[model samples]
Target: VALALCVIFNNSPVGSAISLIGMMLCLAGIFVLQQAHFIAILQVLIYAGAIMVLFMFVIMLLNLKQGENEGWASREKNLLLSVLTGFLAIGILYKISQVLFSVNMDTPASLPDSFGTVAVIGETLFTDFVLPFEVA
Candidate 1:
């Protein structure tokens, strides 16, 4: 919802950036509630802190100003983009509907005692995702 509002306020660059940060923070909170503390910390530190600061810096550095009555594009281009977006949205909805109708709501399998433990997660991270994890 906050992200949708941010997109709606595209004319205000600083406001949009601020709202984007708010949305990231909200996601971090959700992660915390899901017991993914490391992911939550990463979300706040990497997304809300570092990336947003860069975005704000660029916005300020560019000194963007919106002109009165200015459109994002000419009418023809806007119409083309709207048509494309509508088609994309329809495709996504169709895929979602298919999944919803076809899903089998079976009883979930039981998890092992070590499932979601820090040590287990750490082992998988170091073993399977070493390069990408180290790069991050």
Candidate 2:
């Protein structure tokens, strides 16, 4: 829904960026519901926070006015772009269907005892990423 709203608010760059951030937050919520706390946090921090700030900064810097190039494209160019977009959409749908049909929908196996635990994560982080962890 938020993604659809982003498209609907395409005329306003700031509004579209806000809706895109909303979509990112929705995805983060989904990750939380799936018991992926670390991924959810990273999603919120990286995408919704940093990337949205950058996007908004760029949008403000551009200072684009509405309908600045409303009549710039000729009818032939519009038709060509429409056809290209259609083909791209068709290709994406085809790829999605292929993946859907190929993958099994079976229930996943249970997680191990130490899987996703704080102790295990901390130990691995300290061991494998000692320099980076210390640097940060």
Candidate 3:
């Protein structure tokens, strides 16, 4: 429901920019909640702070107006496709959840202070996934 409101606001130019900023912050909060502090901070600094600011400035400079929204009513074929996609997504998620929760993994009693910190994440990324990081 909150997301729908955000999207509705996003139909307006200024509200759209604010909505984008809010989305970036929300995503950062999710990252933090998932124990990915390094990613969360980077998401805020890079996406929410720098990129979104640049986007807002460009939109303001352009003085963009809201365009008419297209495709409010769905066709029968489109509705069928949507239902198929939804079921496929649900099936995939169910399979993944089963795999993930099938094993009873032991929980760690405590994490080091450095866990999910920027420095530690950087070290791990460079050491363990240097090639993929560079390619990306």
**Cα RMSD (Å) per model?**
4.9, 5.6, 5.7
Candidate 2 C-alpha lDDT tens digits along 1-136: 5374444535688888888888999999998887777778989999999999999999999997787756436565557666767887899999999988998879665877777566787888899999998997
Q: Which is superior by lDDT, 1 or 2?
A: 1
* Strongest candidate by TM-score: 3
CA-lDDT, candidates in order: 0.81, 0.80, 0.77
Clashes of 2: 0
Clash count, one per candidate: 0, 0, 0
Which of the two, 1 or 2, has more TM-score?
1
Off by over 4 Å in 3: 67-109
Number of the top candidate by lDDT? 1
Query: Residues 28-136, candidate 3, lDDT per residue (tens digit)?
Result: 8999888998799989999989998998898899998756666354465456656766887799999999977886668645777788887888898999999999998
Candidate 3: residue 51 lDDT (0-100)? 94
